[model samples]
Target: MKIAVVGPSRLPIAPPFGGGLEVFVHRLVSALRLRGVEVDLFAARGSIGHIQSLEFPGIDWTGFEASARDDAYPPGAMESEAAAYRRVRKLLERSDYDLVHNNSVHPAMLVMDPGKAPPMITTLHVPPQPELQQIVDTLGPSNGRFTAVSRFTADQWRIPTPVDVIHNSVDTDQWRPGPGGQGVVWFGRITREKAPHIAIDVSRRLGLPLTLIGRCVEPPYFRKEIAPRLGPDIRWLGSLPPEEIARTVGHADVALVTPEWDEPFGLVIIEALACGTPVAAFARGGVTEVLKDSPAHLAVPGDVDDLVRAARAALQQPREHARRTAVRRFDIHTMLERYLTLFEGVLTR
Candidate 1:
C-alpha cells in the first residue's frame, strides 16, 4: 500500500523540535515500511531535512513548510498551514496514493472537494478548540474518516464526525526500566493545567526530592503561580532528551502526573510505565484508561493530599509488576498492529 502522512507545522520529524506527534509519525512510517508498505512523509520545512531521515526501506520524507508559505493562506497565524494543505491536495491530485493520513489540523481539508480526491484519514491528537471545532465539523464528512487519541478528547469536542479511538503507544524496548536514578520525577510541559504545583506539594509532603523537567512556556504565570513555592527539594531541570527522560524516569522511585484539567491523554504516564516506573496521576481524562490495570495509582483531581497518598502508594508497589503491565499493554508493537488494521481497512474500502 502507498500512503502519505501529513505532519504538524511547528515541528517536523527531526531533532530539537519533534514532540509526541513527530515521534508518532516517524515510528508509524518506520513500522509500516518494515511490513513492506510504501510510505511518503510530508512535513514542515526545517522540521526534517534529508540527512536526519529515517533509513527505513520503501519510505520517503518530503519537507515542505506550507504553513510558512505566504501564498498558502492569508498572512495570518495559520497561513503557512493552509498553504501546506493546498500543497498536499495538489500532491494527492497528481499522485497514486491509496490513502492520505493527515496528522495536522489544516483548514484546507474543507476547501478540497472530497469527490475529486482519494480518501483521507485524520487522527485528532488534541481536542479542538471552538474555532478548530467548527473547521473540523465542516471538513469531517469530506475527510472520509477520523480517529481520536482518546475517547475523552473525542467526546470533549462533541464532533459530529464518526470517530474511532486509537490510543498512542510507546517504544517499550527503548523506554524499558533501568536502575532508579535519584529522586521523584515530574516531566511534561510546565503549565498550570498540568498541575506542576500539585506535584511540588506532593513531593514536599513526602520529603522525596522532586525533579521538574519540561519547558516553562508561560513565564509570567509560572513566576506568579508556581515559582514562589519552589524549595530545595524541588529541582527545576527544564526539558531533557528522550533517552535522558527515560533514564531519569528509570532512576525515579515514582513519577508524579497531577493534571488540573482533564488531560486528553497522559503520554508521560505511559512513558513512565514503559520505564518500569509506577505513576500516581489524577483519575481524570485518559489517565484512568491508561492506568486502569497497572500498579499505578490514581487520585482525585486537584486534591494534593490525595495525590500525596497515591504517590506514596506508587513508591511502595512492586516495580516488576509495573514493568510487566507496561510491556503487556502499552508496547509499540500492539499499537502498531492496531493502526495497521485500521489502515488496511481504509485501503480496502
Candidate 2:
C-alpha cells in the first residue's frame, strides 16, 4: 500500500537524531518500506538518506530562519512551518495514497482542509500543546485517528476522542549487549527539564563516574547547570549516531534518567535496556510505566538520596535481565505490527 508519512519539520529524520521524535519517524518509515509498502516521507531537509527505492522523500520544510534561533518557541520558525504546511494542503489532497500518517504534530497539519485527502492518523509523541489543542478543539474531535507514545500522554489530552497508547521502542538488532563498565550514564537533551544536573549530583553522591551523552539543546542551561559539574569523574559526550550511542550506553553499568517534567515516553530507557544497561530513573510521567516490568529501579522525583539508592539497586540487577526485558517488551517488530494493525483498522473504518 502507498502511504504518506509526514514528520516534524523542526529537525531532519537522520543520524545523530536531535530527539526521540526524529528517531521514531526514521524507524517507522524505514520499517514500512522494508515491508514493501510504498512510502513517501515529508520531512525536514537533509533527511533523505541512502535508504530505499519506493521510499523517496518529498517536501523539505527546512531553511526557515528564526532570528532568535535557540529560544524555546522560535518566532519565525513556527510561522514558516505553519505556512509551509498550509501550502502542502494541495499536495496532500492530491496524493492518491492509501493513508497519510501525520507524525509532524504541527498544529497547521491538522488545521488544513481535509476535503479530498486520504484518511489521516497522527501519533502524538508529546503531551498536548496549546496550539495543537486549540486546533483539535476547533476540529471537534473527529479530524483524524490519534495515538500517543505513552498512556500518561494519552490521558493528558482533554479531547473527546480516544487516543491509542503505543509505547515507543528501539530496533534491538541495532543495539547489542556490551560488557558493562564501572561508570554511570545519562543521555537525552541536556536541558533543565531533562535534568542532567540531577544525574551528575546522584553520581557524585554515589562516588560513581558519570558519562553524559546527547545534543546540548540549551547551552545556557548546560553552562549554568551541567558544565561546572564536569570533571575527571564526569564526562559529556555530544550527540552520536544510533550505533555509536548504543555502543556507549551498553558499556555503562547503569543509566540515570532525571526528568523535571512529565516525560511522554522515555525512549532512552528502552535504548539502555536494549544494550543490557539497567536504568535508575525519577518516578515521573511515563518513566514509571517504562520500568514497571523491567529490572530497573525508580526513585522519588528530585530526591538525590533516593536516586542514589535506586542506582545502587539498579547496579545489582543483572545485565542479562535488562536485555531480556528489552527483547520481550520494547522490540521494534512489536511496535511496527501495532502501527500496521492501527493503519488497517483506520482504513476499514
Candidate 3:
C-alpha cells in the first residue's frame, strides 16, 4: 500500500530539531518502509534523507517563543499555518494514496475531510488543544478514527469517538543497559512545562549531580529559570542525537522526569527504562501508565519532597526489571505492528 505519513509541520522530522512527535514520525516512516510498505513522508524541510519526501513549509515554535511578548500566538504564524494546511489539502486532493496518516495537531485537521480524502487516521499525540478539539468536533464520529498515544490522554481529551491508545515506542536495541554511574539524568524540551528546574532542585536536594539534555524552546525560560541554576553539580548539556542520548543517559544511575504539564506520553521514561535506568517521575497525566508496574517511584504531581523520596526508592528498583518491562511494553516492533493493523483496518472499513 502507498501510505502518505503526514508529519508535524512545525519542525523538521530529524532528531535534535523536533520533539516527541517528530521523533515518532521519523521512526514510524523508517519502520514502515523497512517492512516493505510503500511510504511517503510529508514533513518539514530537512527531514530524513533516505525516505521519499514531500517537503512543506513549517513555522518554528522556537522562533515564535523567542519573539512573542505574551502567551498569545505570534503575528502571521496562524496565517502561515493556514497556508500550509491549504497546501496539504491540495496535495491530498490531487494524490492517490491508499492511506494518509496524520501526526499533526494543526490546521490539517480543519482542512482535510475524510469523506473527500483517502482512508486516513489522525493520531492525537497531545492532550486537547482548542483548535484541534474544534476540528475533531466538526469532523464528528463518522469522519475518521483518532488514535491517542496514551489511555490517559484518550480519556482526558474526550474526542467525539473512541480514541485508540497506541502508546509511543522506542528502539530497545539502540538504548540498552550499561554500567550506570552515580547522579540523576533529565531530558526533554527545556520549557517551563517540562520543568527542568524541578529536576535541578531534586538533584541538589539529594546532593547528586544533575545532567540536563534537550533543546530549550523558550529562551526567557531558559535564561531566567534554567540558566541561573546551572553549575558544577547542575549541568545543562543542551540537545543530543538519539544514539548519543542513549549512551549518555545509559550511564546515569537514575532518570528524573519532572513534567509540570499533562504530558500525553513520557517518551523519556521509556527511553530511560530501555537503557536499564529506573525513573522517578511526577505522577502526572500518562506517567503512571508507563510506570504502573513500578509504582513506588511515582510521587504526587509537583511535590518536590515526595519526588525526592520516590527517586530514592526508585534507585533501589532492579535495572534489569526496568529494561525487561520496556522491552515487553514499548518496543518499536510492537508499535509498528499496531500501526500497520490500524492502517489496514482503516483501508478496509
Candidate 4:
C-alpha cells in the first residue's frame, strides 16, 4: 500500500530532538516500510529528505514540504497550515495511494476534498487545541477518520466523530539497558506541567544524584518553576541525542516521570523501560495503562513521599526483567504490525 505520513512542522524529525510525536512518526513509517509498504512523508521544508531506505530493507522514503508562507506561529499558524493543506490536496488530486495516514493535529485534514482524496486516517496525539478542535469538529465528521493516542485523551475531548485508541510504541531494541550505572534520571520537558520539581524532590529524598534531560521551551516558566529549585545534587544535561539518551537511561538505576497535568502518554516511561531502567512515575493519564503489567511502579500524583517509595521499590527489581518486558510488548515490530492492520482496515473500508 502507498501511504503519506504527515508530521508536525514546529520541530524536525531528528532523534533526541523532537518529542514523542515526531519520534513515533519516524519509527512507525520506517517499520511500515520494512513490511513492504510504500511511504511518503510530508513535513516542514528542512525536516526530512530523501532516504534510500529504512533499516527494514524494502521501505523507501519520499519527502514533501509545506508552502513557504505557512511557516510561522500564532496569528499565521492556521493560514500557514491551510497553505500546507492546499499542497497536500493538490498531491492527492493526482496520486492513487491506498491511504493517507496523517499524524498531525492540524485542520488541514479537514480541508482536503474527500471526493478526490484517498481514504484518510488521522492519529490525534493530544486533546485538540481550541482552534485546532474548531477545525476538526467542523471537518472531522465529514472527511476524516480519527484515532487517539490513548483512551484518556479520547475521553477528554468528547469528540463527536468516531475515535479509536492506539497506544504509542517504543523501539525496544534501541532502548534496552546497558551496564548498570549509578544516579537517577529524569527525561522530558522541564515544565511545571511535567513536574520536574518532583524529580528533584525524589532525588533529595533518596539522596541519589539526579540528571535532567529534555529541552526548555518556556524559559520563563523554567526559571520561575524549576530553576530556583536546582542544587548540587541535581544537574541539567539539557537535551541529548537519542543514543546518548538511551545510554544515559541504560546506566541509570531509576527513571522518574512526574507529570503535574494529565499526560496523554508518557513515552519516557517506556523509553526508560527499554533501557532496563525501572520507572517510578505518578499515577496519571495513560501512565497506569503503560505500566499495567510491567515491573514499573506508580504513586499517587504529586505525592513526593509515595513517589520516593515507588522509586525505592523499582530500584530493588532486577533490571534485566524490566528490559525484557519492554522488548516483548513495546518492540518496534509489534508497533509496526498494529499500524499496518489499522491502515489495512482504512483501505478495506
Candidate 5:
C-alpha cells in the first residue's frame, strides 16, 4: 500500500531528533517501508535520505509551545506552519495513496471534508488544544479514526468515538544496557513544561551530579530557570545524537523525568528503561501507566520531596527488572504489528 505520513513541520524526521515526536515518525516510516509498504513522508526540510519526502517550507518552530496557550506561536510562526499543512492536506485529498497517517497537531489538515480524503488516522501526540478542539467540535464525533500515545491523553480529549491507545515503543537493541555509573541523568527538551530545572533541584538533594541532555528551545525559561542553577555538579550537555543518547542513558545510575505539564506519554521514561536505567518520574498524565509494571519509581505530581524519595528508591531497583520491563512492554516489533493491523483494518473498512 502507498501511504502519506505527516509529522511536525518544526524539525526533519531525522536525527538528531528534536524530541519524541520526530523519533516516532522516523521509526514509523522506516518500519512501514521495511514491511513492503510505500510511504511518502511529509516533513520539514531535512529528513531521512531513503524515503520519498514532500518537504514543508522551512520555518523556525523552536518558539512555539502548546497550541492551547495564547503565546504558543511567535509572529507568523503559526501562519507558516498552517499554510504548509494545508498545502499538504490539499495534495493528500487528490493523491492516490491508500491511506494517510497524520502525526502532526496543526488543525489546518482537519479543515478538509472526511469524505474527500483517503482513510486518515490521526495519532494524538500532543495535549488538547483549543484550535484542534474547535475543528474537532465542528466535525462532530465521527469525523475520522484516532489514536493516542496514552490513555490519559485519549480521556483528556474526550473524543466521543473510540480512540485506540498505541503507547510509543523503543528498540531495545539500540539502547542496550551498560555498567551504570555514579551520576544521575535527565534528558528531553529543556523547555518550561519539561522542567529540567526541577531535575537539577532533585539531583542536588540526592548529592549526585546531574547531566542534562537535549535541546534548549525556550531561551527565557532556560535563562531565568535553568542557567542560574548550572554548576559543575549540575551541567547541561545540550542535545546528542540517537546512539550517543542511548549510551549516555545506559551509563547513568538513574534517570529523572520532571514534566511540569500533562505529558501525553513520557518517551524519556521508556528510553531510560530500555537502557536498563531505572527511572524516577513525576506521576502525572501517562507516566504511571508506562511505569506500572516496571521497577521504576513514581512520585506524586509536582512534589519535589516525593520525587526525591522516588529517585532514592529507584537507585536500588534491579537493573535487570528495568530491562525486562522494556523488552516485555515496548518492543518495537509489537508496535509495528499493531500499526500494520490498524492500517489494514482501516483500508478494509
Candidate 6:
C-alpha cells in the first residue's frame, strides 16, 4: 500500500533528537518500508536518509523554547506552520497516494481539504493543545480517523471525535539484556515535569546510586531543584543516544520513571522492560497501562517512600520475566501489525 506519512516539521527525524515523536516516525517509516509498503515521509530538512522524504521548511523546536517555558506559542510559530501546511496541501492535491498518515503536531488538518484528499489518519502523540483541539472540534468527524498514543491521552481530548488507543512500541532486539550493575537509572527530558528529583530521593532512601540521563529542557529547574542534590550517589551522565541508552541503562539494577505531570506514555519504562531491567515508576497516566500486570513495581505519583519500597520489591522480580513480557506486548512487530490493520480498516470504510 502507498502512504504519505506527514512527520513533524519542527524537528528533523534524526538521532539525539529532542522529542520521542521524531524517533517514532523514523521507526514507523523503516518498519513500513521493510514490509514493502511505499511510504513518503514529509519532514524537516536535513533528516536522515533511507526513506523517500519530502523536506519542508519551518522553525525548529528551539524557536519555541521561550514559548514552551511560558506555556504559549512563539510569535512566528503559527506563520511557519501555516507555510508548511500550504506546502503539504499542494503536494496532496497532486499526489495519488492511497492514504495520508499525518504525524505532525501542527494543525495540518486546517489545510487538509477532505473533499479532494485520500483518507487521512492523525496520531495525537501528546495531550490536547487548545488551538489544535479547537481545529479538531471545528472539523468534527470530517477530519478523518484519529488515534492517541495511549488511553490516558485519549481521555484528555474534549473533542467529540472518537480516538483509538495505540501504545508506542520499542525494538526489543536492539535493547537486549545487559549485565546489570549496582545502581538504578532515570532518564527523560530533564524538565521539572519529569520529576528527576523524586527519582534521586528514591535512590537515596534505598542507598542505591542513581544514574541520571537526558538533556536539560528547563535550565532553571535543573539549577534550582536538581543540581544541589547531585553528589557521589547521584551521577549526571547527561544525554545519550538510543543505542547507548539501551547498553547503559540496561546494566542498572532498576529504572526509576518519576513523572510529575500526567505523562502521555512512558517510553523509558518500556525500554527498560525491553532490556530485562525492572522499572519502578509512578502510577499515573500511561505508566500504569505500560506496566500492566506488573503492579508490584508501581507507587503513587510523587511518593518517594512508596517508590523506594516498590523499587526494592522490583529488584526481586525476575529480569527475564520483564524482557519476555515486554517483547510480547510492546515489540515493534506487534505495533506495525496493529497500525496496518487500522489503516486498511479506515480505507475499507
The residue pairs found clashing in candidate 5 are none
Candidate 6: count the clashes.
0
Candidate 5 per-residue C-alpha lDDT over 1-349 given as tens digits, one digit per residue, 9 for 90 to 100: 9888888877777888888999999888888888898988898888774334457655554435433222355667667777777788888888788988889878877665677788788899888889898888878654578999999999989576899999999988898987788589999987888888899899999999999998877777888999998998988889899999999889999999999888899999988998989999998889989988743488888899999999999999888989988888997888899999999999999
Q: TM-score per candidate, in order? A: 0.85, 0.92, 0.94, 0.87, 0.93, 0.92
| Candidates, ranked, TM-score | 3, 5, 2, 6, 4, 1
Q: Which candidate is the best by lDDT?
A: 5
Shift of residue 212 alpha carbon in model 3, Å: 0.5
User: What is candidate 6's local distance difference test score?
Assistant: 0.83
Backbone N/Cα/C clashes per model: 7, 0, 0, 5, 0, 0
| Top-TM-score structure, candidate number | 3
TM-score of 1: 0.85
For model 1, residues 1-349, the per-residue Cα lDDT tens digits are: 8887777665557643335676777767777778888888777656543122421111112333222221133234355455556766775766788887877665565455676666778788766666667776666566568788888877876556678888888888889786664768998877767778888878889888888888665565578767897778878877677788888889999999987778878888888888878899899897888888843488887878888888888888777778888888778788788878888898787
Query: Cα lDDT for residue 271, model 4?
Result: 89
Lowest lDDT 10-mer window, candidate 2?
Answer: 50-59
**Residue 253, model 5, lDDT:** 97
Between prediction 4 and prediction 6, the one with superior TM-score is 6
Writing each residue's lDDT as its tens digit, candidate 4 over 185-230 gives 9998766678787898899899998989987655666777678877
Q: Which stretches in model 5 have alpha-carbon errors above 4 Å? A: 49-53, 61-71, 294-296
The lDDT ranking, best first, is: 5, 3, 6, 2, 4, 1
**Better candidate number, 1 or 6, judged by lDDT:** 6
Task: State which candidate, 2 or 4, has the greater TM-score.
Answer: 2
Q: For model 6, what is the error of residue 137's alpha carbon versus the real structure, in angstroms, after optimal superposition?
A: 1.8
